[model samples]
Structures are given as C-alpha cells and as structure tokens.
Target: MTRTFRRGGTGGAGGDLDLYQYAYLAGGGLRVAESAVVSLTERGTLSLGAARLRVTGEERPEHPVELAVVVACPRSKPVREVIESVGHSSEVDVIARRLVSLGLVRRWRRKPTRAGRRRLADAASAGQVPAYALRGPAALVPGSARRGPLDVHPALGDLGRALTRMGKALDDDRGHGTDSSADAGGFGGGGGDW
Candidate 1:
C-alpha cells in the first residue's frame, strides 16, 4: 500500500509522505501503508486500509502518545533515557508496548535473532551502525528485527488518533467539571450534588 502525505502541522512542514514509500511513518499494529496518499489536512479524505478516517483536527496539538513513539524510536535516545525523560506514565507505557509490538523497538532482555545479529554484523562490517539502529530509540531486547515499521497496521493510526482525541476531550472536560458534589461516593473525594 502507498500513502501520499503533505505535512503542515505543529511538527512544522514535513515533506510529502507516501506510506508505501515510507513505512516508517507508522508504528506498531496501529496502521501502515495505504493504496493512495492523501493530504492529512483534508478531513475525511483519507481512507486507511479499508477503514475510513477523517482528519478532523488539523491544528490540534500533538498528543503525548505521538511523543511516546518519538521517545521509543531512540533516533532520539536510549530506552532508559526516554523513560527517564518522559517519566513514568501509563500512557507512555501503553505507547511503548504498542511500539514493541510493532517491532519499532526492542526491549533489552531479549536476545537478537539471526537476522538481527546479521544486521548488527553487517553494520559492524560497514564500520557504522545505521541510523535505524543508532537513531531510533529502541531497547533491542532479545528478539529479531522480524518486524519493521512496515509491520504496523494502518488501523493503528486510527487508534492513535482516537486515543489522542479522547485524551484531549477528557482534558477539556476537566476544565468544565459538572459532577455532583456527592458523586464521589466513597472513592475518597467529593461526591455528586447529593
């Protein structure tokens, strides 16, 4: 699948993107590739795989979830460093897990597979670790690079977008609290208006 993308968001202007051409754009099973490229600015113009998606929030802020990928990609830093930078958050953990599943990253405890070792060896032979190995924030846990960005499913994009929206909505709603004083019941705080 191929996807064409033009970037003009908070991340600044990015080059036109084609998922087929750049599978790295996606991470995990979230989503990858497309039959055609669509400008992310055009809402409802893009269809991920078979799922229909609308790019509603063009100017919406970049979600922490997105940053999670950035942190794990080590193209930024080591895994431990990323965790330290982002601090501990369930959200970050979720993103890390998803990233790991997508094969965008590897945990440290696992052994590298033949292919992984071969790739490492190849890099050693080349006298330089490829950017993918050095730049991307990956733990390289005992596992093989069996999966790459191409392995990410396109639907994951929708999931990421949805999670982003949900989180933002919650944050927005938090500012307009409407819960009753007694609604808290015994949870340890105020309750609803009861």
Candidate 2:
C-alpha cells in the first residue's frame, strides 16, 4: 500500500494554520519504499488500493494512553522503564497488556539475575519479570531512518507536540481553574469583546 498526505497552506499571515492528513492502507498490508512519501493537508484525500478514505475532526488533546503507546512502540523495553518514561505507572501496564492482546506488542518474562533481582527486589514481584516488545509493524511505522533512543518519526512529531501542549494546558487549568473566559479577549477597553 502507498500512503500519501498533504497539508494545506504555507505558514504566514491570513493563512490557515490547522494541520490535517490522510493515511491509507491497501491489500491488507503496507509496502516499504525508499522514496515513499505521506503528505497531509488541511483537506487531504487518501487512496488505498481500490478504496478511498476520508478523515475529519478537530484534533483532540493528546492523552497519556496514546503517548505511552508511542513511547513503547519503537522497541522492546523493560516494563518498568516504559512505565517510568510515560510517567503513568498504573496506566502503562494496562496499555501494554491491551497492546499485546491487540497484536501490536509482545510480552515476555525475563528471568531475574542475582544483580537484577537485587536491583529490582523492592520494585518487582517474585520470579521472572515481564517485558514488552513492539511488533514489527508498530516499530516499522516510524520508518527505517529513525535514530536515538527517544526519537520518533517525523510523521508523529505533531502528536508529541500535542502531548506537550496538553500537559501545559492541564497545568494551567489546575493553577487557574477551568474557566478561561477572563483571558478570552485582550487589548483596548471595549470589554475586550470582538
């Protein structure tokens, strides 16, 4: 399957700033190509084999659940590390289990060594420890050029930004409460209404 996405407009005054894209799947599988490109547009169209797909909606705030998956999707990591990286210990386990059930990740037991057992004695349960590994497709979605331990594909950068924005928004909401009407408008003295 070939996936192409195109985002509309250039960033400038009076130009639309919203981002949009389409992802298509064809013949029940994705193909790897050196020159493959996926373009995303504000009003983009997607074609998958003989089927056409359309996606529409306002982007929702990024949740920890999705962030956890993205963080753990690139490689096999110790369960504790995955939990720590996402900072959602309780939720990460559930998400990992679900991913395993969904066939997106695989879970296995790693027998604890003497040193490992000592290090994790306080943190882990008896016997072997559980670890998770991303399935081929989940890891390959980021492409072959992805680098570093924490790097995600360029295509997923927007999602990372959304997660950051959501964290800031939640922090602000906690500090100032949910009502933001006070800052709804600014400048001039006309009650700040436009």
lDDT of 2 by residue, 57-132 (tens): 2322253333333334244333223323443344444534543343333345312234322322322232111110
lDDT of 1 by residue, 1-194 (tens): 11233333332212332222122222222222111112221233222221123333323324443334343332322222332333344544554454345443465432333433443344335433322223222112111122213445344355344323322332233342233545646576546687
What TM-score would candidate 1 get against the native? 0.20
lDDT of each: 0.31, 0.26
Prediction 2 global C-alpha lDDT = 0.26
Best by lDDT: 1
* Backbone N/Cα/C clashes per model: 35, 8
Worst 10 residues of 1 by lDDT: 28-37
The lowest-lDDT stretch of 10 consecutive residues in candidate 2 is: 20-29
- TM per candidate comes to 0.20, 0.18
Q: What is the lDDT of candidate 1?
A: 0.31
RMSD of candidate 2 to the truth, in angstroms, is 21.4
| Global Cα RMSD, each model | 19.0, 21.4
